[model samples]
Target: MRTIAIGDIHGGLKGLVQLLNKLEVRDEDELIFMGDYVDGWSESAQVVQFLIELSQKIECVFIRGNHDVWCEEWLETGEVNMTWYIHGGMETMASYDDFSDEEKKEHLAFFRKLKLYHLDDQNRLFLHAGFTSMHGVEKEVHKPTLYFDRTLWELALAMDNNLDTKSYFYPNRLKHYHEIYIGHTPTTNFKCDIPMNAINIWNVDTGAAFKGRITGMDIETKTFLQSDPVYTLYPNEKGRNKD
Candidate 1:
């Protein structure tokens, strides 16, 4: 059985379908999604539906991304901050316009039930975003894993900008897991490769929503497959522009 780890979906259902079709996934294959399953595209609702349906057919692990957390908040309170709406939540809301109230409730429940992280039997850890390295921070801290805590985000951003590998938060000294798969920060942050690892943190978000490709990593072979750009954004045509 082959194991494939896919990068962020970010509501790009067409892109997701194309990638899956290209992969020709088998029933015995293990498919793991790193998260950011919704927002930033016209089919957030459809994406969720597809994931729900796919879960029944295969061994699928869905990790929660920052956008998913915003979705949960909106579902629970019927209100969200402007930041959430500005960062693709508006698109997600648009996708749900045709849903019945009951359907919406069910969808929200599914989002709430998503796991914050998943660890494979191989000791490979999958999470939506980077974890805090500070002592006493729980392994299950929902805020940083789901949303960008300002302090942690800033620190990561700075490290990336400076290309300072030593500044990264190496989870458990990188010995606990063979590799850590993460999404949320775009792959553009690093040059040459879509997989960016800093202090053992591996970021796989390939910017699919901004017209970049969806990436799939084969852990055993250490190989990767990238679908052609299916979605486009303004300012830059290659999908490098931050939307």
Candidate 2:
């Protein structure tokens, strides 16, 4: 069975749809979504609805992203934090406003149930952001670290050779899994604009929230199937204004 890991979608339903078309996913294959499925583009609700249908058809492992969590908080309690709104949350709320009560409940449940990380059969770790290095990769990681840390990626990138061979290993961060895949830190920030591998760590968030394309990579082959420019997909509106 093929294992496909996707980068953060950031509410770009058009981009996600295009990227998935490129994937041509097989039923038996496993899908690992890196998350941030909302709060960037103009179709957050549509993106959630698509994933709901997608989960029924594919063996999907949905990992939680910070944006998804924030959305859930509002969905469950109607409590909107101004900070969230400033960072693309307004778009998500606007999109969700069109959802019916039942639809909102279903989407909220899906978001509330998302996992912070997923470990594949190959011992590869897939997460939305980074992880705490306090414990080994096999040990359970804290939820916040899973969707918010960047130090993990930095440590992996700075390593000489995958960290296993380092003479003075710092147990505070990465290279503990056979391979680690992350999304929070956009690859566009690194100027790659595509899924990139540093040492054994893969950074898949190609900044779909901004001007970059959404990415879906075949984990085994390292083949990337991407969407058209996300900004172009939503020409009339601003994506995450901060992207």
Candidate 3:
């Protein structure tokens, strides 16, 4: 029963499909998606539709992302956020052109049901972005921080790998989880097109919204698989690269 942590899809359904084909998933396997399922490529609606069906067949944990929040709001209120628009929301909206209102409602429900974070039985923590609470996610005051914060990853990167957990110097937040998996900030930002680890925090977002590929990592073995560079799969679309 492998537990796989997947990176942000950013509406790259082709990349997601390719990555899944490489995974050869099993019925007992648990899939934890890091969100941003929409808002980059041409298949935002299709990606959401696929995930909805996939969840019915397997154990799946979905974390809500910043872009998802914007999308959810639009779906419920029919008000488009200008910021979200300039950052690929237009593509997402257009993708839903063929979907019925009932189907859109179903998709909205999926978005609303997404968890802010998931703490596994083994104490592994998974979230779309980060949290600011030094105490841990349970104590987080601003819920939105879970999807929008970057400081947690920044701190993980800045921490000394040698820092002992017993030492006063260790981060209080990281101490609460055996492992942390996140996907908001792409690993590609560091010029690496693969999942990256900083101490116990693993970043699986390999910039699928741009030139990097979608990634999936086994939580226990740390083994991973990826699709071809997402841009290559959708050659006609620039994805978020144009931004």
Top model number, TM-score: 3
Task: Please write out the lDDT profile of model 1 over residues 126-157, one tens digit for every residue.
Answer: 77765564432235455554445333333444
Give the Å shift of residue 65 in candidate 3: 0.7
lDDT of 2 by residue, 1-243 (tens): 888899999999999989888888889988899989999899999999999999999899999999988999999999998888988899999997778999999999999889878886778888888766557544645657778888878877776663454556644445366888899998888888988787778998998998898999889999888999899999998887553
Where model 3 places Cα greater than 4 Å from the true spot, the runs are none
**Backbone collision count in every prediction?**
1, 1, 0
RMSD list, candidates in order:
4.7, 1.9, 0.8
Error of 1 at 1 (Å): 1.2
TM-score order, best first, reads: 3, 2, 1
Cα lDDT tens digits for candidate 3, 1-243: 999999999999999999999999999999999989999999999999999999999999999999999999999999999999989899999999999999999999999999999999989999999998889999999999999999999999998999999999887888899999999998899999999999899999999998899999999999999999999999899889985
**Worst ten-residue run, lDDT, model 1?**
232-241
Worst 10 residues of 3 by lDDT: 234-243
Structure candidate 3, residue pairs in collision: none
Error of 2 at 209 (Å): 0.3
Where model 1 places Cα greater than 4 Å from the true spot, the runs are 134-172, 191-193, 197-199, 232-243
What TM-score does prediction 1 earn? 0.81
lDDT of 2 at 129: 80
Which model, 1 or 3, shows the larger TM-score?
A: 3
When sorted by lDDT, best at the front, the candidate numbers are 3, 2, 1
